[model samples]
Target: MTFEQHISGNIEYLERPGSIGGPVLVMLHGIGSNAASFTPLLDHLPRDWRVIAWNAPGYGGSIPLDAEWPLALDYAAALKDFLDRLELKRVLLAGHSLGCLIGAAYAAAHRERVVRLLLSSPALGHGVPCGGALSAAAQARIDDLQTLGPDGFAALRAPRLVFEPESNPEIVRYVRDGMARVSLPGYPKAARMLASGRLIDDAERLQVPTDVIVGAHDVVTPPDSARRAHAALRHPWRGAFTLVPGAGHALYQQAPVAFAAALAALAETVG
Candidate 1:
């Protein structure tokens, strides 16, 4: 099934409508990615379910937040606005990488609105306080973007996001292309959010069923980090942590079938 891209209010999203009154799945991408990052995973998803992936604030045609360094809650507020604009009361929220931080904040703040939560290759932010000095890792990302530009930065970093670029050239190229499209304001803002975010704090407050998935070979956010995030979950889904072997940070793209299976498993549990 093909996804139709559209702008709802200030948010741009890709949607594939399924059966009327069918289950809804909403996806949030990582800092370097936009909604298109979820396209591959969406194709493998159930045809009877509705899926929507949003370009977080500052990406695509979505408006940037007013704050120079927006917090996870700020992004959560933007997410709330996007969902409200779509008239969606409840949804199964799936977040990847940096998106996990935002999703955790949203789910914790509005637990009633999220039916289930799935976090992939979760990035546990550096926990730097707002207005404080950024971590060396976070500063390096910002420095790379500024020094290398989008294309150069993407070329240099995208390869590391996947486990084996030689084996998954197409997926690597896809990820590289997505990263290359990340522009200013949004990219920098997301970096700052990462510097300040501590996903575990929000994860600990979550009352909804949650699951964590990570690439065993992921270098960006390794399985150990994913396990830590899973351990912090207040209500872990089936008390499980999924490890996608031979995949990396971009697990959804590198292993879409496994990612889809995870979503299918979540649906089964809820139904």
Candidate 2:
């Protein structure tokens, strides 16, 4: 499959075109990742599926939001506009970490556009009491980036994101490279958005099918957190919660086959 850049309106994305009648899968990357982060995972998906992975606002040369610190809804609005520009009326939406926050918000706002929602290494941002801790952590991330700079921040943060960085040099390099591409001004704003996210509330309000997948060893948004997010799901729209073995926060990179398997299952079952 070939991946290339496409710009419609003001948004830029990396897209792998699919055969006619195939399902459309739109991927949203995590905070420290770009559209390229989904390459390995995309390789494991069905060849016929149309896959489009977006470099979220400010990442990978994409446009940044005008606001100093935009909310999750702001990011979701940009996503909606991107879809509209492309004329993608319906798609299977998947997201990782911070992307999950945006995906959930988008699904809540535009229920008809998303057929199914898949959240990988899901990061649920509850507001207020729990939000306080998340906000502080997000600020710390911004502070660390400011102090360390891109390369330095990637060096220190990349290894910890995976389960076994010392033994997995290749994955370490990949993660580090992705992190190094993070947009400084954009990242701080994203962190602030994450700090104020309301994913659980959105999940409760969702009317379409949704699934949550997480790596068993993920320290950042561990299995417990994924479970809690699933538990918070309200009646009719609630879906499955899966834990993939031998992976961590960067599960899509470390165990892409299993990650894709979970995603494929969701696609087949939901379709």
Candidate 3:
């Protein structure tokens, strides 16, 4: 289900080979997370698709990014290099949270190399600058990032992001423990980028067929923002938005079956 191989860059990944042999699906996790973050999604996956979850530099088992890792473009470049090394010229890109932002940027910049893009908890743009409120929120995240490192962050985040644990405490705990193990420095920078990063103006020109998956209870990136993003795309069909009821931002973990069902439905459009 997982393995380590040296591509141009050292990448830790989870690979679920599909029998159909199309472009390998490239899955990128949100910031402060790793390739293994999508275990739930993998579990629901079928053999017709080769699913690979990539650990962005400094997260999970991937090598650490340079201290001065390129902000947005640098990250995109890494993805480009990564795909090229794997000999996958074009790929189906699925990303969550900050990873969504990264995937969108890549697709927008290299339209020729992307077949489809699926975004979950996407970071379309910075939350409306709510004066001090936004700053306060960001600072709190920064503080937490510093305090929790990987494990603590996971512990704190799982309960909030995943569906109620009384519903399935052990399941939630399993995810939290993995999240908490994420790379330290990678977590804060990811948070910083999402807080101030702007992609709305750029995504206005994205060309690939794209879908935004939103969880109804997602406080991280609300549905209203998703609707705004949906309206902004030049190709509206290329950027559809779907909501997951009774789930939060990490629904792929909280409710993998539903998430896979949605993704499978989207696959039909791609075909």
What is the lDDT of every predicted structure here? Answer: 0.90, 0.85, 0.70
**Model 2 weakest 10-residue run by lDDT:** 126-135
lDDT of 1 by residue, 104-184 (tens): 999999988998889889999999999999999989999999999999999999999999898889989999999999998
TM-score, structure 2 vs. true: 0.94
Q: What clash count does candidate 3 reach?
A: 5
User: Residue by residue across 110-213, what tens digits does model 3's lDDT show?
Assistant: 98887778877776646434232344555676687678666676778777766566687877786677777765576655655566556676568788788778
Q: Which candidate wins on TM-score?
A: 1
Instruction: Using lDDT, rank the candidates from best to worst.
Output: 1, 2, 3
TM-score against truth, every candidate: 0.97, 0.94, 0.87
**Ranking of all predicted structures according to TM-score, beginning with the best and ending with the worst:** 1, 2, 3
Residue pairs clashing in model 2 are none
Instruction: Output the worst ten-in-a-row residue range by lDDT, candidate 3.
Output: 127-136
Between candidates 1 and 2, the one scoring higher on lDDT is: 1
- What is candidate 1's TM-score against the reference? 0.97
Collision pairs in model 3: 18-49, 19-47, 150-180, 151-180, 210-238
- Model 2, position 262, has a per-residue lDDT of 72
